[model samples]
Target: MSKRMNSGASQQFVIIGSGQAGGWAARTLREGGFEGRIVIVGEESHPPYERPPLSKAVLTAQKPAESCYLWSKEKLGELNIDAVQGNRATAIHRDRREVELADGSRVPYDRLLIATGARPRRLNCPGADLPGVHYLRTIEDSERIRGSLSKGGRLLVVGGGWIGLEVAASAVSMGVPVTLVEATDRLCGRSLPESLGRFFMDLHLRHGVDIQLNANLTRLEGNGRVERAVFGNGEAIEIATAVVGIGVVPNTELAADCGLPLENGIVVNESACTADPCIFAAGDVASQPSSWLNGRVRFESWKNAQDHGVLAASAMLGGDALTRDIPWFWSDQYDVNFQLLGVPSVGNQVYQKGDTSSGRFTQYFVQANRLTAVAAVNSPRDLRDAKRSMQNKSQFDTTGLVPVLTL
Candidate 1:
């Protein structure tokens, strides 16, 4: 077992970034019988909340912003957590064991957690900083985009990643016309294979969304707000509101400045412990070892945020780490529930089952007769079984895996 914090002493557990990971870590510390002074610092004024709904329910105005909050003020108070809101962590003074904030405050910690989540990669083009070009990372951002969609006009969505697709779907659901621009030829190029990308393409295309592939956006041309977008292909389209969902840049400045190992993100062990024994990192800001990947990887999924937070807290309290599961993530686009379990690569042989015409099927990726990854469209049960197959690393069984479609 790892050495626990000295609870007998006036232990001060300071958590930086009150996002999913930080909030859960604070609660875990309290729940794990650590009677310590816990403080959770967040740049946002709101308490810890889930961001998944921002592109889905919240964007479509199906749910209120408060519904995404993981903890209410009353709940935070009940946990005895000193919630410091609306303060950016400027620097980490490792020698002094303190973190300096933008407000000229230094908070000390016996154990520190760096959960500083990532920020949206702003669109870089002419008139990019115009008023109408928005990025969705917070509830406030989502609400603003929702307002824009409600006003009724063509919404220009840039990037073909999950964020852009979700935003486009939400707008379509809101009965707003959407024209999606992708620099690449397909959607979610990094995560999805060509076949899966086609699935998404068909999904959006069927929904009456104008998808422009290999269409590089040159610039935004407008008077006040963004009124039009120019493409490298010498085509321009007038738009009412614009949303950029290119990607996110992980907030690794604090970790890098403080001298914690940084790669794509703050390097940490499976237990979420950093190189420095006094500190740990988790969530989107953490790049930790993954058995599934056979290497270290940084995940930007909601599952990673919550699980890593709990793991970090357990490690802090000298408790056994939680069971690591296969990295799984799901997306709700239009009316289809798309999910993927395990990391899919290009070389894997895909054996697809079920009918895509019905809009419910599972695609299995196998290499060397072993299940490597699985993608499902509205087939949660098969996806659940796929998780078990992945956990066992079982050889492919064609008994029930009869391929109706092979990719």
Candidate 2:
């Protein structure tokens, strides 16, 4: 048990895990006119920062890591939010409404928010513990990748998802020989359609990125540092470093320990409230109920996390508004910006509106005669309109979409 801080009659609100969701919740709470003592606990040394730039812009030397912060230190001070950085929350006592930190300290709160977020999944095999193998999920990881790429080194990337593909693009642009391996037959098999995946395969191959589909890694071979990777198909590739981008696992241990409803993440109602009214969970760590998608879904996107933060804060302030914003996600790869709007899984039919070969197009995923999702590549105009339509649940004639784009 940790020592509890005496809040001294002040209405204290403690938020666990100060990443994107935590930062947004703190800001929203103050903005919502809750003049409570807002305390945000984060495990990272730095304040809450954006993660999308870690693999693309920051790794490619296109942007600085400092530019990714959601709020400045001075801004946080002005908001009167206490940011407890470099400290991990070990447990949550729901009965007492207190949070325990790793350093044997506890903070009592009138209300609590869980925004612990997710962590990158790691490869577990021989030489997996090697020092040179890296995963990009934080600013430190991006800085290390940028430093390694500066040497023009040979890089082996595991997984063919958005993170792996984006990092491979950056490495190749830096004149680094890169090989990307995926267990699936195509890149982004879970997120993208086969046509788009094939297009990405060709695009990466044309850009000098060696992409190996349906390739599985057996083990990582090295002395103390990663030197080579052995594929399950009896093929071995020599490389100076390897990056593993095999998705993320939600940090739901705390919620689970506290006996909160958890499926893929911390389960919450449509209002982002847990079984306990005083406690709320949001962001990637939250399996929130979405009326837009007609189900409870956990989204691991930057925008979704921020939106959940705002919604959860509003709910805590006795606001009953429901969040109907269609889930949106974006990724930047090789000078191409890809944006996805709405729930792609709900789409039954897909229509491509522009030339995919030119890498500027929009693919609409339609379900039950309604547009359910839209994936736009280098087409921000379509992406914005698609988001608006999804939010309004507007029905569009598939045949007339291309003409609308022209106008």
Best by TM-score: 1
**How far out, in Å, is residue 282 in model 1?**
0.2
In candidate 1, the residue pairs with backbone N, CA or C atoms under 3 Å apart (3 or more residues apart, or in different chains) clash, namely none
Per-residue alpha-carbon lDDT of candidate 1 for residues 1-407, written as tens digits (9 for 90 to 100): 45665363487889998888998888988888889799999999899999999999988888999998888889888888898999999999888899999999999987889999899998888989887889999999999998887877899999999999999998988899999999988899989888789889999999999999998898998898888999887889999899998889999999998889998999998788999988999999999999888898999999889989999998888766678888888999878999988898657778888877789988998878888889999999998887887888777785666553433
Q: List the residue pairs that clash in candidate 2.
A: none
Per-residue lDDT for 268-340 in model 2, tens only?
9877889888899999999977765677789999998898898888777777855447778888777678888
Deviation from native of the Cα of residue 151 in model 2, angstroms: 3.4
The C-alpha TM-scores of every prediction are 0.97, 0.93
* lDDT score of residue 303 within candidate 2: 92
Taken over the whole model, the C-alpha lDDT of each candidate is: 0.88, 0.84
Worst 10 residues of 2 by lDDT: 1-10
Can you tell me which runs of candidate 2 are displaced by over 4 Å?
1-9, 400-407
Highest lDDT: give the candidate number: 1
